[model samples]
Target chain A: MTVNATILSKPQVKNAGKLLAVLAAAALLFAAFLLANGADPLAIYSNMISSTLFTPYGIGEVLIKSTPLILIAVGTCISAKAGLVNVGGEGQFAIGALFSTAAGLSIGDSLPSFMGIVVMMLAGVFGGAIWSGVAGILKIRANMNETLTTLIMNYIAYQIVSYFVFNDLKDPDSFNWPQTAKIAHSLRLPRIAGKINLGILIALAAAVIVWLLVRKTKWGYSLRIVGGNANAALHAGINVEMVQIVAMLLSGALAGLAGAIEIAGVEERLRQTTGVNYGYLGFLAAWMAWNDPAVAVLTAAVIGFLSVSGNVLEISSGLPSSAISILMAIVLFAILWKGKGRKSE
Target chain B: MILESLLAGAVQSGTSVLLTVCGETVSERAGVINLGTEGCMAVGALFAYIVCAETGQPFLAIPVACIAGGLMGLLHAYFVISRKANQLATGLTLMFLGLGLTAFLGRNYVSVSTEGFTKLRIPFLADIPIIGDALFDQDPITYLSYLICAGMCLLLYKTRFGLILRATGEDENVVYAYGADPIRMRYLSVIMGGMLSALGGAQLSIAYTHTWIEGMTGSRGVIGVALVCIAAWNPAKAFIGAYIFGAAQALQMILQQQGLEISSFLLMMIPYVLVLIALFAASIKKNGKMPAELKKVFEAV
Candidate 1:
């Protein structure tokens, strides 16, 4: 195999072994945390593993959760490659859901199922693009900190969604609950098996496409150059600002698609709480995978499993579901700790 | 009367953000952006609330909260300085760790109440006009916040230790050449930042809110980070910046009280939107030179 092809493959046996060792260390640390919290680590860990891996329904739920995570992570990779952090994925996702739902509501039963779904997805994409575009524009024009702007906007977007749900989007048939009416039946994604829909496939396909684009395209080359050193890219006659902005837009668009798919494929209605924390989780998944789309698929699944296990921890160990984040953070810390010397040197 | 109440309310609410901004200014000047300041604040608030609830002494919670926040800072320092992890990633993870850990540990303390610090109105100052009520007749923590800001300014600009700290942030190698330890300086600065941020959180819970609540800081730590940037990393400017945010929050409440019929959600966005506007204005005006290392961190994106 070519050197590039070999490099593109998974890590060698030794590296894989080291990764496993690191993961094992993280698991041990997490066990200590559970023990300190008065939970039986062995039982909790066993329950987490058995329930998530042993049941078909659990597997289906894992895939469903991973679907958005995969899509959002792929999008996160695009922005990370361009040397930007899109932590606003949460806000963008919320806005995307709002936009898609608005479009779905407007086009209710008027068009064929395929056409309606396409329109909704398109609306979602534009909605996310616009939401993230604000930060991108601020970065270029005002030189504002995108991280803070994006974070603040996440709250603003949530409030906006809440306002709509409580007012214009409130389900009239229901008793004043803050949620939009369910979309037309035809607008829902076709279920492939059990709780699984076509979303997983779509997410995987998007990941592959992103991987190819980032690896092979001219824009990808420019993105790498810009990310490496914007000054150097500017010296090379590249429009650094434009490239970064496009990356932001594309990243947000993908996140928006995740929001839309979530609405059609999972929630089937819009609520203020729809897709909560998915953005942050997806961003973490991308970071865990080091922003590589191919590796992101695996990382997304790992995050999804841990997230599902968080719910299990709540049920079995009587721990708050948020207890899972401690585990997640510890695992990430271990990874960062392990990868340290290599990057610094 | 409205203006008087508004200014007084601004001082009351601004204390927490002011403390955090000062802490962050010190940390960032030492060349590390602890995006986990939010986490530190959250952890601090919880620990402080716990201490206050258990002991019925809000003052005792301050030191405990500082220690708790310092531990978080040490963790971030270990990852960024010793392990050489990415600062942004480390900080974000620290934030999640803080949030999740607080939610986990604080679940039982949700409904607990404590005898928090009450405003200690200065006798002469209380009789003065609007400014006295705004500045002097306040909780001890709020008063301490003003001194902390001044002390931070002096520490960053007027002292030998401050010079070394600022020098370390600008160029670590240069400081190393001078026979100083940049690593230790960064750790100290970060820990100090964490302590101050925690103190802010303590003020929020034991003085302002008087009750333990999950996610109570409400991203105020982030606002602290933003204010630091807008202040151009100057502690003094951050004082003003914090009050501006506090006024925005105060305006929201004032408007709601007046029966203006605005949506609560829209009103809730005011402080955040004001941050965006302030950032825009600061960027346009070229407010101040960001610390050399801090600039690199931002440009690193």
Candidate 2:
């Protein structure tokens, strides 16, 4: 008789248990924070929990936030698995959003409504892929540190976006501060089921695509083999450089898609702060999940929940928004510390 | 006349960026990527502004900021190296922590009336020529940066401790074979690097603006990271990398002042363009020097 492997996988069980305990400790810290502020800890907690799910808009907002996070993290896992650190996810994401916005604004009068949206989304993906591929190419050809190259590329992306938004793309007739013309609704990503947008659906589907690429396909197998052991994979004739470059390009494209989805689904135009920190959050999620693609979705949702809950607490308790960031740091440290429980040789 | 003024601004950028590069060079030498340099700089600027704003002792601001910055570094090292957390995550966290903490705490410290550090020159050198005045006639931080560069050269090459630290960066496990503790050496290296980075951050607030602003570190922190790559793990070369970036940044600011001529955004793209070329070069050199085993083998996420 075939038996379940529950008894055999002892270490995985223990790791899970240990992590659960650490998370419980963090929850206790959250309770303490509420008490220290002289507010009703239970009430705020209940309120945040209720607000997130009880209201339709709150649920929608969480999905909206989760959409981009999922896209970015999945892409992050791809590059990370290929043994490349693509910290330029932020830059790639921004460029995707920027190019998408540019496509929308420039072709505002030219294309049919449905076609414009498709065009914009494609532009974003290509823009992000190429942007990230530059670093990937450098790593392959020049032996550059992808980490440094990607990190530096972020500033270039930021500056160019800043220029486009503030100078060239500025809506001259608009009476408001520095911002672009609102992207036509025709170009926005449509919402599905009147709640979750097409973006979330796209992100979920993309994850499946990536999972297949990394697990089922021959190229995916080669990339993973190389990532697991570069020298060994190289000897086996899996062009390590080719795998890395392809993985990075794919990763960057996904990251860019995430940005485009954010624009299409939520904020229709790009802003300077057009969600930079989301990249960091995605980075965190990917890391916490140990680069596991499926787990990234859950981690992104958890981060979204914490942030949404933190916002509720901030408004009701008069605590600074930064307190949430502090809690995030605590939670992050707790997860990482917990990960170190009972190291193996 | 504007050209000379622009040239002078360029000099300022070189010196200021130098402060950060010198700090990063030391950290990378120990094989730790101190991504918190921007945050440390921001914290330093914030405290420098706050300390000076209080007690009317503007002069004490730099030292105070440096110490506070060192403490922040201590916190970073405690979490990342001590707890064995991922370096990139720790650095990013430090960045967010510094960004939020500085903004929240130093909101009130921004617009206070204060006299800042005045630019001083090496007396004889200041009189000699245009280049000399541009380079030598600057605030004390620039001079301090020069000393730091020289000091880095001596410490990394000449001293026994330097050799040990370098050896530690290459392979802590091997270094562990020796009597010295890798942990302690890392703590010391990271902390010192933090202090120096804070000084670099404080220099902008104290010497340049004479006041602190939230998010003042701008691209400087990221620039510091890029400098290590361009320098190819040599402190001396890192110094050169810093100046090149400084020139790019300074040129951008000058061009903006000159009416955004030549596309100031293009100017903004300067460091990035240089870095792209540098990365291409670095990637070509297959056996480029990366610390034997970066303190943390995996950046954890």
Return the top candidate by lDDT.
1
User: TM-score per candidate, in order?
Assistant: 0.96, 0.92
lDDT of candidate model 1 versus the reference = 0.88
Error of 1 at B44 (Å): 1.0
- B104-203, model 2: which lDDT tens digit per residue? 6776676785666779978888775566776778888777777887888889889988888888788877778887788887888888888888888777
For model 1, the stretches where C-alpha displacement exceeds 4 angstroms are: A1-11, A340-345, B299-301
Clashing pairs in 2: A142-B283, A142-B284, A143-B283, A144-B283
Q: Classify candidate 2 by CAPRI docking class.
A: acceptable
DockQ of 1: 0.71
Q: Write the per-residue lDDT of candidate 1 for residues A1-345, one digit (tens) a residue.
A: 698777555565556677789999999999998888898999999998889889988899899999999989999899888888888889999999999999998989899999999999999999999988999999989887787788888888988999889888889987988899999999998999998999999999999999988889999999988888888999999999999999999999999999999998899899989998888888878877878899899999998998888788889998878888898898888887876322310
lDDT of 2 by residue, A243-289 (tens): 99999998899888888887777888888888777877888787776
